[model samples]
Target: MDCRVVVEAAVPVYDVSTADEAVRIAISKTGEMLNPDLNYVEISMGSRDCPHCDDELEPAFIAADEGLVALELEMTVFNVERDEHAARIARKEIGKRLKNIPLEVLEIEVLEEEDEEEAEAADEPTETEPDGGSGDEDDVLPEFEELIDE
Candidate 1:
């Protein structure tokens, strides 16, 4: 499936007195956290209003708080399958790399998925057939009637 993982995190900056400084530190720290092996990775500092919102979400940073600002941030994992497992793996790697930084991951969201089959699966109801015959209740044996009663 065509999909991308977006990781949201809050990083606390120390010894910084200006918003720009906080951003610089955040970016640098995030760059260190990225995996060089990944095909594509993008990191950005989020605004106080909406942290973790990437380019797709169009995040807006209105005010830059100084002095130990916990900047909101996002790391997008590209060229990966659009699934929970991939997202978790990416999250773990990010957490491992950012162990030195006072970072707290907020959430991992699916930023984009370009898979038609996955979209259809979400909208379609699943169907299954009994071993003996069609899904009709009579097809189930008396001993297994209770199992499929629901």
Candidate 2:
């Protein structure tokens, strides 16, 4: 499948060397007002209720620029498996965590799967198969991934 998950959300960032520092600064910025502790975010894609294994579709792989001290003014998660329900939950949780920061969301675009094998599978359609027998449903590296990794 040729699917990708795209997310965009504004965040307040500060100059920090690592993700740890970035997290601290980000949290603090959002906490400058009332109920600050309520808006502490660890990662844009992570779940507020559960930190571990609770991200918006786990990243199969990742490589940051890691060039210098910096905090994220905005964060995005992309090229993940598309699920409307999950996306909704993830975004809502994130919004709550970043409530103090006041984010300006631009867009969340997803490149859903295109059944490459459809052209072939049609010739062998099942009598009553679920989702066309998952033909061409396997995840593949998104095209943009190559550009970023390069």
Candidate 3:
């Protein structure tokens, strides 16, 4: 059972513009150089995206001209755990490695949209449900066995 990690991070910045600059800073000396595996940075006038990460943390980094700019970055690592618990453990360890980030400087949000997506997809009607049948069990759902017998 292979597991994957999705990391989203954004930091308030100033005097920065363009994705290339952000990328340079991200992979540069003191900024995000620690996370060598860092995959991307998104730019929105001042923000950026890796174009390589999983969820496309376009929302991660942001920026401004004068007041304060923000930079967003996203990344994904594969085959790190054996299951959900192991994944969580790996995440905790990774979180510690990222503790140097200042909350006031950067904001990181790692949402579990995969589960949400799965729930949304599961809500869609399956083939067993007739086109117009209600959700009730007694609502005359189609049965493969009945069709075969017929």
Candidate 4:
């Protein structure tokens, strides 16, 4: 089974002003930490809502030239036995890159293998011939093969 996992991370950024700058710096810093190793992971700004009013809030909070930015990291885990397994794998993999950053598993979505297979099947072209031929003549030859034959 495959699962899509979203993990929330609290990344700390220093010497920053404004929530936007904090979030941008945090994203760039996180990407640098994960690159050349776990480059497949997708990083985005985390969403936060006020608990009392449910009003949308900024992903970063700045205080005294320091900021704690909320970021969401998404990655897909393949061939896992269960959703929990997938989440664990994702956390472990991401944690290794972002050391000392707090991580929480926000969401785990199981990907349906059947759906992927069905979509792939739908994309394949049918090999039907209107003139009752075997359709062998319609087969495309590889460019290298054609060159070699010529």
Clashes of each: 0, 1, 18, 0
Best model per lDDT: 4
Better TM-score candidate (2, 4): 4
User: Candidate 1's error at 93, in angstroms?
Assistant: 1.8
lDDT of 1 by residue, 1-150 (tens): 333555566666566656677667766766766657442556765544434653332232324443443444444655555466666666676667767544444556665454756877656555554253345656557759767886
Q: What are the models' TM-scores?
A: 0.47, 0.26, 0.33, 0.81
Worst 10 residues of 1 by lDDT: 54-63
lDDT of 1 at 80: 59
Per TM-score, the best of the predicted structures is 4
- Misplaced by over 4 Å in model 3 are 12-14, 29-62, 65-82, 100-150
Off by over 4 Å in 2: 1-24, 27-90, 115-150
lDDT of 4 by residue, 1-150 (tens): 999999999999999989999999999999999998998999999998999999999999999999999999999999999899999999999999899999999999998899989978766666664554455654655765788999
**TM match of model 2 to true structure:** 0.26
Query: Rank order by lDDT, top first?
Result: 4, 1, 3, 2
Please provide, for model 3 over 18-70, each residue's C-alpha lDDT reduced to its tens digit, 9 standing for 90 to 100. Answer: 54454445434224543544323222222444667744433224347312223
Candidate 3 lDDT for residue 131: 56
Better of 2 and 4 by lDDT: 4
